[model samples]
Target chain A: MKLLQLAVAVLLVAVLGGSPLSAGARTWQIDPAHTNFYFTVDHIYSKVRGHFNTYSGAINFDPQRLGESSFSFKIATDSIDTNLAKRDKHLQSADFFDAGSFPEMTFASTKVVDAGQGRYDVHGTFTVKGVAYDLVLPLTFAGVKEHPAMKGKEVAGFNGTLVLDRLAYKIGDGKLYKLGVVGKDVEVLVTIEALADK
Target chain B: MKRTLLQIFFLGIGALVVAGGCALPFLYPTQTLWYKTGWEKAVLQTGHLFGVFAFLALVLQLLFGSRGALLERAFGVSLVMRLHRANGQILPLLVLCHMALVLLPEGLANLPLGLTFWPEMVGGAALLAIVVQVVAAQVRQRFSLDYRRWRSGHRWLGYTVLLLAAVHVLFVADSFASGLPRLALLLLVGMMALRLVYRMVSSRR
Candidate 1:
């Protein structure tokens, strides 16, 4: 009787660990209208700030089941906007993102670590210009509540920042970076507002 | 004394124009933001400054070439012609420096090209025009070129360079993309066009 009970318990644990939904994590789709993805980089004497205008993601999250939570995003590389059309074109050219050959940059979480007090460190693989690099984005849960405008809907917000080396991803000409025409470190600011799927 | 005063007044106006043109790039909002290291910033700004000075020199070359009655009276014809020759000789050197400095930061590999870089290509054409005009002027006697033909070609080529440089400046960067800088550039270029037209008509008459 003891052996049978132990086997049943082990099977139950494996099933719950393998399936995210069974573990109580809910699926949430990113609300594009309410989310923002911004980035900044040094350009000669002033910083250039820009954002990706088109992106979509899904989040499987549960405060009680942190281990089962995950996040995945797909951003259209050609949607980069820097206010200056010439610069934007340059960035999208072979010199930078090479958005022509690589139309999308993606991130999928491998792990998420809770740091207490509504903070989390998300480790993921970030791909840009067909180059992939491991990245850790530090995020803060900004709380969840009923949607103000949408009836019978819940919205959750997550904000995070990640510093990436442009050279690692080969985002720009390495020679330019060495000459300090553009700095290597790029700061990406992410604010995601997601809606729970019923 | 009257001639001296007029000379001084015109000289003052010339100095003011150069100063104002040089200041326009720095007045750009992006100028104040810290995006690059001190040395890189210095190199980039110096490159822009060189381009600005070159443009001013080109404009002044036109003014001196005009040999207008007012300029001749304010400064003798000999002095004006001498200034014109000296300015022309230095123009090529200024342009080379501007090109080198601007390319240093981004490197030669990233030298802008293609249809997307039309403004920069226009600037490149202007540089080529300068080279052609200078070389032709220097070799005219060797080639036994006709004086009238050479002068006419030189005049039209100078006008072309002026127009090309103006378009490059107006569209090349965000600094002059809008607002005060755009207005100032249009006014300056328009004034030059008017002056050139007036000179052409007056000469024909």
Candidate 2:
């Protein structure tokens, strides 16, 4: 029992970390060419897949920093593609996304928790079309490596997926709110490739 | 009785077919016959099929049941009522299927499947309105309220579907987009307007 207790204490201490990471310790710039934001919808009997074609964002990485690391991004709502032109327009109209009134969908991270093994669960507020909601993203790190495209530059990756219930933010709200015609629970798949500045 | 039954039988089979998946080409005004395009025609055909069933069920509900009798009749009343209920439930699914065929593809087709075409959003607000009413009806039913109140909701959704479809045929369609289909589409709207006027005048009396 004494041996087990000591082992548990050591594990807890190691897991807890020596100290919380300070703010602005390490800032990472996003590479637009590498990042992607994809979403899915239920199209009646079938499922429709789409994504935002244009977006830009930056991330501040501080592993132990809960409130220190900041992330922000803006995606052009009009650049959304389900591959269909007319439906995309309808999605932007009043009955659906109302992208005309509220164009850019944005997200800014508030806090991130290190879950060991270079994994993190980021809590961020995401504004889609116009509605805002708190989002939790469970992320897996792809590790830092020498970027093949850029000489002497290192890039870090984090891939995460989250189910977004459109009704929460009222993206396509109201009764027809039915996954009936539209879809319920849009999948938000994000791939962030950030570069270390120094 | 048999003629009505025959019409209903055909309508039922067609509705189930289009509603369930096999979208057969059937056009209104009875003139164009089965002229169809790749998929839009499939959707129109399905919606038309559902409309046929809706019309049949409306007629059955109109002529068959004793709305006020309460508990008088048996056997046949229960049977017809059952059919009416079945038809009622299936009706919206068919409409939804039809709506998806036309609407979903406009956005989804761009993917690798090419199942949807990014076409035109010709319906001003009709489709949107229908979505609202349908949801309200479901809520009302779930809440165990009077189905009669749903009539108003039902009527509005129907009107929206018909109106928007007319506009859809006019501004958006490619082949039947203009000329005679336009005229016939207008005629359907006119008929709907007249029905509304008649109902309003009679209700006021």
Candidate 3:
């Protein structure tokens, strides 16, 4: 009877301890003021650079419990700015992102693999224009420090680059892309700074 | 010898116009997409060149028909009339080529329509006006149309074509959308308008 009770106790402790809620994962809110999501693509012989003006995300991170760490982000598609209003309108039109139908793009991490040091390989599903694609983002955690202005609050920084296939996402007219009106691969550079929830 | 020198000078001006129009696309190229293949680049460039040529040809048609003192003295009234007729025939062909080449890479299925493509629609209107002007002129004698009435209609249609063409060129492409190219186009159109106005006022007098 005692042996059975001891087994039950051990199982309960193991189950509770392994739960993500109890894994010491810290929830961090993305700081829109400091975060940047810039993208670059080849436009003929030149490179066109643009960025999303509105995006928000959260990071659930615990260095000790890497398996429980995850990241999620949502970006407003209409907030894309390429410094040219005409191009931006085209990007938001049916020929491109179709922002009227798909107003937001989202990303959710499925797995996170530590690569030693401050680097991590985050495998996630990125949904754009109503299509989801598996993507792996190699990110560097730039350590954490107390907010200089906001005393007692902690801030963490992360940055990574992601290459997206525009055709796969149906972001633009395939025929135009084939004729080289726009590039196939779009490189996205992400820089995120988050404040740990109190 | 003086007449020959004047002819050479006019020919040099025509060459400069053609060269300048062709060079605008390259010099003020919009950083949109680097064409993937040589064939596409050539086709697209040729399409733009044709558009420029068509506009210039329309302007030349006006110049030939103007019966200006310099043109009358250099080429005689009969020769100027022949040049005007020949340019009218070629103008429609150049416009046709421009439409075909520009639409080739973009595909006919993706041809932009409605108010959103206002500049392209203006170009279409200009093309329609050119065709009507040319066809009417061709059939004028067969239809027993009075020369005075036909000439008045032709002059008005010419003005309309020039207005539409100027608007299309200014708004249709990125090259002439702004900067020095836009300023130059405005200056050329301004000169053409002044000449037309002068002709109208002088004829009335």
Give per-residue CA lDDT, model 2, range B17-93, as digits (tens): 34432222233232211222346445545554554443333333333332213222322456656665565555456
A172 in model 2: Cα distance from truth in Å?
1.6
Which regions of candidate 1 deviate over 4 angstroms?
A1-85, A88-198, B29-34
Q: What is the C-alpha lDDT profile of model 3 across B43-145, one tens digit per residue? A: 7777888988898899899889777887777778999999999999999999999999876655454455667668889999999999999999989968888
The RMSD (Cα, Å) of candidate 1 is 9.6
DockQ of the candidate models in sequence: 0.05, 0.04, 0.05
lDDT string, candidate 1, A1-198, tens digits: 999999999999898877755656688888998897899988777899999998888798888777788988999987889986556665766668777688899999998899889998888998887778888878899988998888888999999987888887888657667776788899999999999743
- Candidate 3, overall lDDT? 0.83
The predicted structure with the larger TM-score, 1 or 2, is 1
Deviation of model 2 at B88, angstroms: 45
Model 2 Cα lDDT, one tens digit per residue, A1-198: 999999999987786664333224467888888888988877667888998888888787766555577778898876788885655665665545666577788888888888788778888898876667788778887878888888878888989888977777777544554425667678888888999743
Residue-level lDDT of model 1, residues B1-205, one tens digit each, is 9899989999899899888878865777333123334676688788888988998898888888877788899999999989988898899899889889876655454456777679888989999999898888879958888999899889889989999998988777567888987887788779879998898788899
Highest DockQ scorer? 1
